[model samples]
Target: YKASIPKNGGPQIPDELEDPKAFKLKMETAIQATLKSEKAKGETYSQDEKELMIWYNYHFLGRGKPTTHIQVLSSVNNEQIKKNLPPVFKEIFARISSKLKHQS
Candidate 1:
């Protein structure tokens, strides 16, 4: 995992490593919330979850694949997330580009 610096430019510790059990709980809570919300919004929940799992798997599980021929990770700019992902996710729709990085 990338260690991130705070906006105040202060050093910070990643707490997820501090308590593995608590970290699992947090993961469960977030996933459950996503399940409920995604289901409510549309019929695409299963496909959505599949894509999410693939992206996260690449990030944390060392597995790789793009969803529906779309490279979702490359669509996100880490700097852009520093702005849009705060308060809540402002999802940027993926657009086809000749450029996108991937690892197989």
Candidate 2:
């Protein structure tokens, strides 16, 4: 299965995900290359395709809580979804985690 991070309201990728090194820039480059590839140009995905695949979209919350929150949509067990349908998206920042960050 494949996943994707939306351009808007997605996780806040810092200017420097790493230290002095530019991990964010590298990540963006990789993502762009993957998105703009010939294969992608030939077959650009649409929003309705979100049904069979996993998605990560962001939203703002009020109160003392964090300003932005991440959301996930994964419910393959649902009978409404066909079991034969496979994922058809590529993950960009889906595997990111706090442990990958270096606390300075």
Candidate 3:
């Protein structure tokens, strides 16, 4: 959900979000043209889709354990997103650090 600024100093929107329609078009074109042309050996389309979903779940949802989440949130340097998230995610995110803060 966060985007690092590009080296060109342009507005930092992730490629996936920058122009979803364009991304979809590119994906469809690649699948229908390039791969078909190459006759690349790979899993079937349905199998590939399933594998992508599994990978997404593992990499995105699986890593959201509270401890890892805290570590990641604490490292954010984006003041705007950090500020915006605080009101919404504060209690959930603060459980660990707030405990430490109280103890200290």
Best by lDDT: 3
**Model 1 misplaced stretches (Cα beyond 4 Å):** 1-14, 37-104
* Model 3, residue 49: C-alpha shift (Å): 19
Task: List candidate 3 stretches off by more than 4 Å.
Answer: 1-77, 86-88
Q: Per-prediction count of colliding residue pairs?
A: 0, 0, 0
lDDT of each residue in 1-104, candidate 1, tens digit only: 12232264321212567986765454444444445453333244564563354334334334223341234445667786566453433333322222233321
In order, the Cα lDDT scores of the candidates are: 0.41, 0.34, 0.49
Regions of candidate 2 where Cα sits further than 4 Å from its true position: 1-21, 37-104
Better of 1 and 2 by lDDT: 1
Candidate ranking (TM-score, best to worst): 1, 3, 2
Clashing pairs in 2: none
Residue lDDT tens for model 3, 9-98: 322222557887765544444444434544543346664553343333333444554654565566676786567675547777788788
TM-score of each: 0.25, 0.19, 0.24
